[model samples]
Target: MERKYLYLDYLTCIGCETCETVCDFIHDGSPHIRIYVTENKQYLPINCKHCDDAPCVRVCPTHAIYRDEDGAVRIHEDKCIGCLACLQVCPYGVPFYSLKVRAITKCDMCADRREEGLEPACALMCPAEAIQYGPLVMVLELVNERRAKNIPEHRRELGEEELRKSVSSGYVLL
Candidate 1:
Protein backbone atom coordinates (compact mmCIF):
# COMPACT_ATOMS: atom_id res chain seq x y z
CA MET A 1 0.00 0.00 0.00
CA GLU A 2 1.65 3.16 -1.20
CA ARG A 3 1.36 6.15 1.07
CA LYS A 4 -0.92 8.70 -0.52
CA TYR A 5 -0.53 12.47 -0.60
CA LEU A 6 -2.75 15.40 -1.48
CA TYR A 7 -1.50 18.32 -3.54
CA LEU A 8 -3.24 21.58 -4.29
CA ASP A 9 -2.47 23.42 -7.47
CA TYR A 10 -2.49 27.01 -6.28
CA LEU A 11 -2.85 28.38 -9.76
CA THR A 12 -5.85 26.19 -10.50
CA CYS A 13 -7.96 26.91 -7.44
CA ILE A 14 -10.93 29.22 -7.97
CA GLY A 15 -11.35 29.84 -4.23
CA CYS A 16 -14.85 28.39 -4.41
CA GLU A 17 -14.46 26.83 -0.96
CA THR A 18 -16.23 23.75 -2.25
CA CYS A 19 -13.55 21.49 -0.84
CA GLU A 20 -13.89 23.02 2.60
CA THR A 21 -17.65 22.84 2.32
CA VAL A 22 -17.66 19.17 1.43
CA CYS A 23 -15.34 18.30 4.28
CA ASP A 24 -17.43 20.19 6.82
CA PHE A 25 -20.59 18.58 5.51
CA ILE A 26 -19.23 15.11 6.03
CA HIS A 27 -17.42 15.86 9.30
CA ASP A 28 -20.43 17.89 10.48
CA GLY A 29 -18.41 20.82 11.78
CA SER A 30 -15.61 23.15 10.85
CA PRO A 31 -13.32 21.67 8.25
CA HIS A 32 -10.26 19.54 8.95
CA ILE A 33 -9.05 21.13 5.76
CA ARG A 34 -8.94 24.81 4.93
CA ILE A 35 -8.53 27.21 2.06
CA TYR A 36 -6.53 30.35 2.62
CA VAL A 37 -6.44 33.29 0.28
CA THR A 38 -3.00 34.75 -0.18
CA GLU A 39 -2.29 38.42 -0.80
CA ASN A 40 -1.20 37.52 -4.31
CA LYS A 41 -4.65 35.94 -4.97
CA GLN A 42 -3.42 32.39 -4.65
CA TYR A 43 -5.63 29.93 -2.81
CA LEU A 44 -3.74 27.73 -0.41
CA PRO A 45 -5.48 24.54 0.60
CA ILE A 46 -4.01 22.96 3.70
CA ASN A 47 -4.48 19.66 5.48
CA CYS A 48 -2.43 17.46 7.76
CA LYS A 49 1.21 17.25 6.62
CA HIS A 50 1.39 13.66 7.95
CA CYS A 51 5.05 14.04 8.72
CA ASP A 52 7.23 10.94 9.02
CA ASP A 53 8.64 12.58 12.13
CA ALA A 54 5.32 13.77 13.48
CA PRO A 55 5.58 15.92 16.58
CA CYS A 56 1.97 15.45 17.63
CA VAL A 57 2.37 11.71 17.98
CA ARG A 58 5.50 12.21 20.05
CA VAL A 59 4.04 14.93 22.27
CA CYS A 60 0.58 13.57 22.98
CA PRO A 61 0.57 12.89 26.70
CA THR A 62 -2.29 10.41 26.38
CA HIS A 63 -0.84 8.94 23.20
CA ALA A 64 -3.94 10.01 21.31
CA ILE A 65 -2.26 11.17 18.16
CA TYR A 66 -0.84 8.53 15.92
CA ARG A 67 0.08 7.95 12.33
CA ASP A 68 -2.32 5.65 10.53
CA GLU A 69 -1.08 2.79 8.39
CA ASP A 70 -1.97 4.82 5.31
CA GLY A 71 0.36 7.63 6.49
CA ALA A 72 -2.25 10.05 7.85
CA VAL A 73 -1.62 11.66 11.18
CA ARG A 74 -4.85 10.92 13.01
CA ILE A 75 -6.19 11.62 16.45
CA HIS A 76 -7.76 8.91 18.52
CA GLU A 77 -10.70 10.92 19.78
CA ASP A 78 -11.57 8.42 22.50
CA LYS A 79 -8.18 9.02 24.06
CA CYS A 80 -8.13 12.78 23.58
CA ILE A 81 -8.66 15.01 26.59
CA GLY A 82 -9.01 18.05 24.35
CA CYS A 83 -5.93 19.46 26.10
CA LEU A 84 -4.99 21.01 22.77
CA ALA A 85 -1.46 19.71 23.11
CA CYS A 86 -1.57 18.54 19.53
CA LEU A 87 -2.28 22.08 18.32
CA GLN A 88 0.72 23.44 20.17
CA VAL A 89 3.12 20.90 18.69
CA CYS A 90 1.77 21.04 15.15
CA PRO A 91 3.74 23.35 12.87
CA TYR A 92 0.80 23.55 10.45
CA GLY A 93 -1.90 23.56 13.17
CA VAL A 94 -3.96 21.01 11.28
CA PRO A 95 -5.92 19.62 14.21
CA PHE A 96 -8.94 21.51 15.54
CA TYR A 97 -11.43 21.39 18.39
CA SER A 98 -14.57 19.81 17.02
CA LEU A 99 -17.72 20.66 18.92
CA LYS A 100 -19.61 18.16 16.85
CA VAL A 101 -17.52 15.30 18.16
CA ARG A 102 -16.26 17.08 21.27
CA ALA A 103 -12.68 16.21 20.47
CA ILE A 104 -9.62 17.31 18.61
CA THR A 105 -9.58 15.88 15.12
CA LYS A 106 -7.69 16.06 11.86
CA CYS A 107 -7.99 14.52 8.45
CA ASP A 108 -7.50 10.79 8.21
CA MET A 109 -7.50 11.00 4.45
CA CYS A 110 -11.21 10.28 4.73
CA ALA A 111 -10.32 6.87 6.02
CA ASP A 112 -13.72 5.30 5.47
CA ARG A 113 -13.83 6.66 1.95
CA ARG A 114 -10.28 5.59 1.25
CA GLU A 115 -11.03 2.13 2.55
CA GLU A 116 -13.67 1.95 -0.14
CA GLY A 117 -11.14 3.06 -2.76
CA LEU A 118 -12.49 6.57 -3.01
CA GLU A 119 -10.63 9.83 -3.04
CA PRO A 120 -11.23 12.39 -0.31
CA ALA A 121 -14.24 14.63 -0.90
CA CYS A 122 -12.05 17.69 -1.25
CA ALA A 123 -10.01 16.17 -4.03
CA LEU A 124 -12.98 14.44 -5.63
CA MET A 125 -15.25 17.48 -5.72
CA CYS A 126 -12.88 20.32 -6.53
CA PRO A 127 -14.37 21.93 -9.63
CA ALA A 128 -11.05 23.26 -10.79
CA GLU A 129 -9.34 19.93 -10.19
CA ALA A 130 -6.92 21.87 -8.01
CA ILE A 131 -6.64 19.23 -5.32
CA GLN A 132 -4.96 16.05 -6.46
CA TYR A 133 -5.06 13.00 -4.17
CA GLY A 134 -3.09 9.83 -4.78
CA PRO A 135 0.32 8.35 -4.19
CA LEU A 136 2.96 11.04 -3.70
CA VAL A 137 4.62 10.58 -7.06
CA MET A 138 1.34 10.63 -9.00
CA VAL A 139 0.09 13.72 -7.21
CA LEU A 140 3.34 15.57 -7.79
CA GLU A 141 3.34 14.57 -11.42
CA LEU A 142 -0.21 15.85 -11.98
CA VAL A 143 0.44 19.16 -10.27
CA ASN A 144 3.72 19.72 -12.09
CA GLU A 145 2.12 18.98 -15.42
CA ARG A 146 -0.54 21.62 -14.83
CA ARG A 147 1.96 24.15 -13.53
CA ALA A 148 4.04 23.64 -16.63
CA LYS A 149 1.07 24.73 -18.70
CA ASN A 150 0.10 27.50 -16.24
CA ILE A 151 -3.38 26.01 -16.39
CA PRO A 152 -6.36 27.78 -14.81
CA GLU A 153 -4.39 30.81 -13.69
CA HIS A 154 -6.50 33.25 -11.72
CA ARG A 155 -8.16 35.67 -14.05
CA ARG A 156 -9.39 39.24 -13.76
CA GLU A 157 -13.12 39.76 -14.13
CA LEU A 158 -14.12 42.86 -16.05
CA GLY A 159 -17.34 43.06 -14.09
CA GLU A 160 -18.23 42.09 -10.48
CA GLU A 161 -15.76 44.65 -9.20
CA GLU A 162 -17.42 44.72 -5.79
CA LEU A 163 -17.39 40.95 -5.46
CA ARG A 164 -13.79 40.75 -6.54
CA LYS A 165 -12.79 43.50 -4.10
CA SER A 166 -14.59 41.74 -1.24
CA VAL A 167 -13.10 38.35 -2.00
CA SER A 168 -9.61 39.72 -2.53
CA SER A 169 -9.76 41.96 0.51
CA GLY A 170 -7.21 40.78 3.03
CA TYR A 171 -3.90 38.95 3.42
CA VAL A 172 -4.26 35.50 4.96
CA LEU A 173 -1.56 33.44 6.61
CA LEU A 174 -0.62 30.28 4.78
Candidate 2:
Protein backbone atom coordinates (compact mmCIF):
# COMPACT_ATOMS: atom_id res chain seq x y z
CA MET A 1 0.00 0.00 0.00
CA GLU A 2 1.12 3.51 -0.74
CA ARG A 3 1.37 5.24 2.62
CA LYS A 4 1.36 8.91 3.44
CA TYR A 5 4.04 10.48 5.63
CA LEU A 6 4.56 13.91 7.08
CA TYR A 7 7.40 16.05 5.71
CA LEU A 8 8.41 19.22 7.44
CA ASP A 9 10.58 21.80 5.71
CA TYR A 10 12.67 23.36 8.44
CA LEU A 11 13.87 26.05 6.12
CA THR A 12 10.36 27.15 5.37
CA CYS A 13 8.94 26.78 8.87
CA ILE A 14 8.61 30.05 10.73
CA GLY A 15 8.42 28.56 14.24
CA CYS A 16 4.72 29.23 14.21
CA GLU A 17 2.69 26.84 16.36
CA THR A 18 -0.13 26.42 13.90
CA CYS A 19 0.73 22.79 13.21
CA GLU A 20 1.05 22.06 16.93
CA THR A 21 -2.17 23.93 17.65
CA VAL A 22 -4.15 22.13 14.99
CA CYS A 23 -2.73 18.79 16.06
CA ASP A 24 -3.57 19.53 19.71
CA PHE A 25 -7.10 20.33 18.73
CA ILE A 26 -7.43 17.14 16.73
CA HIS A 27 -6.02 15.00 19.51
CA ASP A 28 -8.13 16.44 22.32
CA GLY A 29 -5.68 19.13 23.45
CA SER A 30 -2.56 17.01 23.38
CA PRO A 31 -0.19 17.95 20.59
CA HIS A 32 1.45 14.92 19.12
CA ILE A 33 3.69 17.13 17.00
CA ARG A 34 6.56 19.02 18.54
CA ILE A 35 8.63 21.89 17.18
CA TYR A 36 12.31 22.30 17.91
CA VAL A 37 14.21 25.44 17.15
CA THR A 38 17.83 25.04 16.21
CA GLU A 39 20.60 27.38 17.30
CA ASN A 40 20.38 28.91 13.84
CA LYS A 41 16.68 29.50 14.40
CA GLN A 42 15.33 26.83 12.06
CA TYR A 43 12.11 25.24 13.23
CA LEU A 44 12.02 21.46 12.97
CA PRO A 45 8.72 19.76 13.54
CA ILE A 46 9.20 16.28 14.93
CA ASN A 47 6.59 13.54 14.75
CA CYS A 48 6.25 9.83 14.32
CA LYS A 49 8.00 8.32 11.31
CA HIS A 50 5.86 5.16 11.56
CA CYS A 51 8.88 3.02 10.80
CA ASP A 52 8.43 -0.18 8.81
CA ASP A 53 10.42 -1.95 11.53
CA ALA A 54 8.67 -0.08 14.28
CA PRO A 55 10.28 -0.89 17.60
CA CYS A 56 7.23 0.40 19.40
CA VAL A 57 5.14 -2.33 17.85
CA ARG A 58 7.67 -4.96 18.77
CA VAL A 59 7.97 -3.83 22.36
CA CYS A 60 4.29 -3.51 23.11
CA PRO A 61 3.65 -6.41 25.50
CA THR A 62 -0.09 -5.96 25.22
CA HIS A 63 -0.06 -5.76 21.44
CA ALA A 64 -1.53 -2.33 21.71
CA ILE A 65 0.59 -0.90 18.92
CA TYR A 66 0.08 -2.26 15.44
CA ARG A 67 0.58 -1.16 11.90
CA ASP A 68 -2.48 -0.54 9.80
CA GLU A 69 -2.99 -1.28 6.11
CA ASP A 70 -1.70 2.16 5.25
CA GLY A 71 1.54 1.43 7.18
CA ALA A 72 0.67 3.78 10.00
CA VAL A 73 1.56 2.58 13.46
CA ARG A 74 -1.66 2.85 15.44
CA ILE A 75 -2.28 2.56 19.12
CA HIS A 76 -5.22 0.51 20.29
CA GLU A 77 -6.15 2.57 23.31
CA ASP A 78 -8.15 -0.18 24.89
CA LYS A 79 -5.25 -2.58 24.60
CA CYS A 80 -2.68 -0.23 26.07
CA ILE A 81 -1.48 -1.15 29.56
CA GLY A 82 0.48 2.04 30.30
CA CYS A 83 3.73 0.10 30.56
CA LEU A 84 5.58 2.80 28.59
CA ALA A 85 7.47 0.20 26.59
CA CYS A 86 6.57 1.93 23.37
CA LEU A 87 7.82 5.21 24.76
CA GLN A 88 11.19 3.71 25.57
CA VAL A 89 11.72 1.84 22.30
CA CYS A 90 10.56 4.35 19.70
CA PRO A 91 13.61 5.91 18.06
CA TYR A 92 11.79 9.21 17.54
CA GLY A 93 10.14 9.26 20.97
CA VAL A 94 6.80 9.82 19.26
CA PRO A 95 4.70 7.84 21.69
CA PHE A 96 3.62 9.38 24.98
CA TYR A 97 1.50 8.26 27.86
CA SER A 98 -1.71 10.24 27.98
CA LEU A 99 -2.43 11.03 31.60
CA LYS A 100 -5.98 12.05 30.80
CA VAL A 101 -6.88 8.62 29.46
CA ARG A 102 -4.10 6.78 31.31
CA ALA A 103 -3.10 5.26 27.98
CA ILE A 104 -0.57 5.75 25.21
CA THR A 105 -1.29 8.18 22.41
CA LYS A 106 0.59 9.17 19.31
CA CYS A 107 -0.02 10.63 15.94
CA ASP A 108 -2.06 8.42 13.64
CA MET A 109 -1.40 10.75 10.75
CA CYS A 110 -4.93 11.91 11.16
CA ALA A 111 -6.17 8.46 10.20
CA ASP A 112 -9.80 9.36 10.77
CA ARG A 113 -9.58 12.40 8.52
CA ARG A 114 -7.56 10.53 5.94
CA GLU A 115 -10.25 7.90 5.72
CA GLU A 116 -12.59 10.74 4.75
CA GLY A 117 -10.12 11.94 2.08
CA LEU A 118 -8.91 14.94 4.03
CA GLU A 119 -5.36 16.01 4.66
CA PRO A 120 -3.93 15.99 8.18
CA ALA A 121 -5.02 19.02 10.14
CA CYS A 122 -1.45 20.15 10.77
CA ALA A 123 -0.61 20.17 7.07
CA LEU A 124 -3.77 22.06 6.30
CA MET A 125 -3.13 24.65 9.00
CA CYS A 126 0.54 25.30 8.23
CA PRO A 127 0.74 28.97 7.40
CA ALA A 128 4.11 28.74 5.62
CA GLU A 129 3.22 25.54 3.74
CA ALA A 130 6.07 23.87 5.58
CA ILE A 131 4.20 20.70 6.39
CA GLN A 132 3.42 18.19 3.66
CA TYR A 133 1.86 14.75 3.51
CA GLY A 134 2.17 12.26 0.66
CA PRO A 135 3.92 9.12 -0.53
CA LEU A 136 7.39 8.65 0.97
CA VAL A 137 9.19 8.89 -2.35
CA MET A 138 7.59 12.20 -3.26
CA VAL A 139 8.12 13.56 0.24
CA LEU A 140 11.81 12.65 0.13
CA GLU A 141 12.14 14.34 -3.24
CA LEU A 142 10.70 17.51 -1.79
CA VAL A 143 13.03 17.28 1.17
CA ASN A 144 16.03 16.89 -1.10
CA GLU A 145 14.94 19.75 -3.33
CA ARG A 146 14.44 22.10 -0.41
CA ARG A 147 17.65 21.00 1.28
CA ALA A 148 19.65 21.56 -1.89
CA LYS A 149 18.14 24.98 -2.40
CA ASN A 150 18.54 26.01 1.23
CA ILE A 151 22.08 24.84 1.85
CA PRO A 152 23.18 27.11 4.65
CA GLU A 153 26.05 29.54 4.06
CA HIS A 154 28.18 28.07 6.84
CA ARG A 155 28.35 24.74 5.05
CA ARG A 156 30.62 26.30 2.45
CA GLU A 157 33.37 26.22 5.05
CA LEU A 158 33.32 22.43 5.23
CA GLY A 159 35.68 20.16 3.26
CA GLU A 160 34.29 18.25 0.29
CA GLU A 161 34.02 14.95 2.19
CA GLU A 162 32.49 16.70 5.19
CA LEU A 163 29.89 18.39 3.04
CA ARG A 164 28.94 15.08 1.44
CA LYS A 165 28.61 13.46 4.87
CA SER A 166 26.51 16.34 6.13
CA VAL A 167 24.10 16.21 3.24
CA SER A 168 23.79 12.44 3.41
CA SER A 169 23.09 12.62 7.13
CA GLY A 170 20.22 15.09 6.52
CA TYR A 171 21.96 18.02 8.13
CA VAL A 172 20.64 21.38 6.98
CA LEU A 173 24.30 22.16 6.09
CA LEU A 174 24.69 25.02 8.50
Who wins the TM-score comparison?
2
lDDT of 2 at 154: 39
Estimate, for each residue in 22-99, the C-alpha lDDT of model 1 and write its tens digit: 998987766778887879866677788778798889988999887777777788889998988889988988888878
After superposing candidate 2 on the true structure, give the runs of residues whose Cα lies further than 4 Å from its correct spot: 36-44, 150-174
RMSD versus native structure for model 2? 4.6
> What does each candidate score in C-alpha RMSD?
6.9, 4.6
> What local lDDT does model 2 show for residue 163?
74
lDDT scores for all predictions? 0.77, 0.81
Error of 1 at 40 (Å): 8.2
